[model samples]
Target: MARPRKPLLSRARIVAAAAALVDAEGLEAVSTRRLAAGLGVSGPSLYNHFRTKDEILEAVADAVSAQVDLSMFDESDARDWRTALHDWALSYRAALTDHPNIVPVLARGPGRRPAGLRVADAVFGAMVRAGWPPAQATYIGALMRYFITGSALGSFARGFVDDETAYDPADYPHLGQAHLLAERREKVDEGAFETGLRALLDGLALQYAAVVPDAHAAAGTER
Candidate 1:
């Protein structure tokens, strides 16, 4: 028979299938045999593209990282670091939120993933260019990663059971309306994220002033 126009299996195809499995059934559901079966190929064929399942999961995580928007870090953009950081955090959280199943692997840090490295590099480079000391810039990158990933790990509002009786006034006096939160999970979660992001940026702005005495004034002028 003639060679197929498209190769039956490739790295991209493997990563995509693995990612879909993860998204639908959590990380533990992915295995080379299952992935090959899903791809309609022999199990060993997947090894031609990926040596192991761990490597495939890493690629899936990196694919999620690539979805984040880093345009706010553009050198030509005159926005202050605070604004840029705020926008970047929002974008980062969004990507994580969409792929909550992969957040665990991503929380392990970039781990030599190309797209993940770009995210870290962009945040650190932008902070340094914005006049933050190198050490502080590094801290900012780590801090943002921790916050964004933690937020994506689970939904706070959904933590509360939807049954109104779950929060008894006798046992939990302050949680009178706690059960209502699950019904408004999206709004509550988003509001919490925004509130936390603003608080972080506001605190960072104060620190920026102390580190770069004229940064506040310059930022004001730019705005």
Candidate 2:
């Protein structure tokens, strides 16, 4: 007896389902079997679309990367380097934070993923367009990514901590004070994000400017 061919499941749908699973029930809940169950198919069916779980993650990351508005940073913009860098960084951070379940994964081995490379390309594009040298642009991209991920992780931790811990102001003054700040003006809020992002961008711009004097000079000359 000939078996009927299984209907095609779109790659976009699979990745979107995986992303939804991660959002609903953390990354640990995502597996080939589980996703298949969610998708009304058998485990083997997923392998037809995604070679491995990592591939699925890569696809999901690519979907997330697509959320960034690359057009916002014009290659021909007359804005200064810091302004351009600020625009790029803010957009990148916003996209990452919107996918909180996946933000931590960004710090991990998306190194081999093309979607991850898209992010790097955007950062490099912004810097290069602003007359930054290749080396400095690379440094700025790495620095900004690291800092943004680190800050996001810290802010994200507060939510998990609140759910798990019985925090008291009396025992830990500084932590309590910080918690109070978060409570009154949340870490994940726009103000906190703007402040953290601005501070990091400021430091990065300063360092890149100092070490890449020739590049800075060229930027000024171009203007």
Candidate 3:
């Protein structure tokens, strides 16, 4: 088959197609030959832009980062880092929900992706400016990553199929409502995330208070 139009074979187009494949299938499906076949371009053409499949995967990971919202810091009151972190964590999970296959690769850290680095810089910068110690601010970023990536990897809400007769009330008396609860797992997941986010921020505030008591003093007015 003839090569695809040269314009269609640019780095962005290639990365987009590769990412789409991973989004549809799993990450294992993104080999160079497969990616090129999907794009209607010769495999060699892909080499002109990327040296290897890992390079393409890196770009794909960065593409996923591009969709995350950083507006928590951009538009919110800068002093309200607790609220900002909560919003940012929500946005992080939302973005990963759309491109979940990329989560493993993204969990590997920013590597050399410019967009990924910018995300780290933005979050860390926001927390530090809000009076968190430098080491604590970095830990906070890592702490969010630990939970966010783990959340992306699996769904707590994805319980067994709902069946009224699955749980015998005689054997497990307290689990009688399990059937009904499982059906509303989406709400359960959202509520759990919100509850955990509030608690995490509340705990972090104590650390911030110890180091920056005055900052908390002023922020208490907003509470």
Candidate 4:
């Protein structure tokens, strides 16, 4: 089939095509051949923009990262670490939810991608500026990511299948009516995210207070 006429192939086009392919199919489906076809270009043409498929995928991952709203940690709110981190986690989860296929790649680490580095810089800087010890702040960042990414994986509220007879009451008592909760599965998931975020932030707030009592005293903040 003859390729369509449009904008010439470029790095942006390659990365966008790759991301779309992954979204439509899966990560495994995003090959050079697949990306070329999606972009209406020859396979070799892609190399002009990216030498290897991995480079293209790195761009794709950064594209996904670009969607996350790290503005919460901007200069205006840098000192309010609790709110900033909480908002960032929510935004991160929402962005990953849009590209479920890309979440694993992002969770592994951002691999020097520009947009991903910005997110890391914003998050880590905010935590440290708010007086969390550097090591502790790093751990908190990892912890929030683990929670958000795990939440993105599956529904904690949607336990098991919705079939009433799927589970034998004799074998499992409490899980028998589990399907009933599936109807409100989304609410359950949202509630869990909020509850967990609050608990995690509250715990971290205590640690932050302990680490920099002088800062807290000077700021007169009760977070």
User: Considering every candidate listed, which one attains the maximal TM-score?
Assistant: 1
Q: Which residue segments of model 1 deviate by more than 4 Å?
A: 1-7, 217-223
Q: Which of the two candidates, 1 or 2, achieves a greater TM-score against the reference? A: 1
- What tens digits encode model 3's per-residue C-alpha lDDT throughout 74-172? 645563887778878889899998898999999999999998898899999887888788998899999998888787886675675588898898998
Candidate 2: misplaced stretches above 4 Å? 1-7, 156-182, 185-189, 208-223
- Which digits, one per residue and each the tens of the lDDT, describe model 4 over residues 74-124? 778544777777778888988987898887788788778999898888888
**Better model by lDDT: candidate 1 vs candidate 2:** 1
Candidate 4 accuracy as lDDT: 0.81
- Clashes by residue pair, model 1: none
| Count of backbone clashes, every candidate in sequence | 0, 0, 0, 0
Candidate 1: worst 10 consecutive residues by lDDT? Answer: 214-223
* Candidate 4: residue pairs that collide: none
Q: Please give the CA lDDT of all the candidate structures.
A: 0.90, 0.70, 0.83, 0.81
Per-residue CA lDDT of candidate 1, range 172-219, in tens? 999999999999999999999999988887777778878899656357
Model 1 earns a TM-score of: 0.95
Give the per-residue lDDT digits (tens) of candidate 2, residues 91-175.
7777777787777677773576776787778778877876677888888778777876776565643553432135555775556
Ordering by lDDT: 1, 3, 4, 2
User: Model 1, residue 72: what's the lDDT?
Assistant: 90
Report the candidate with higher TM-score, 1 versus 3: 1
Which residue pairs clash within candidate 3? Answer: none
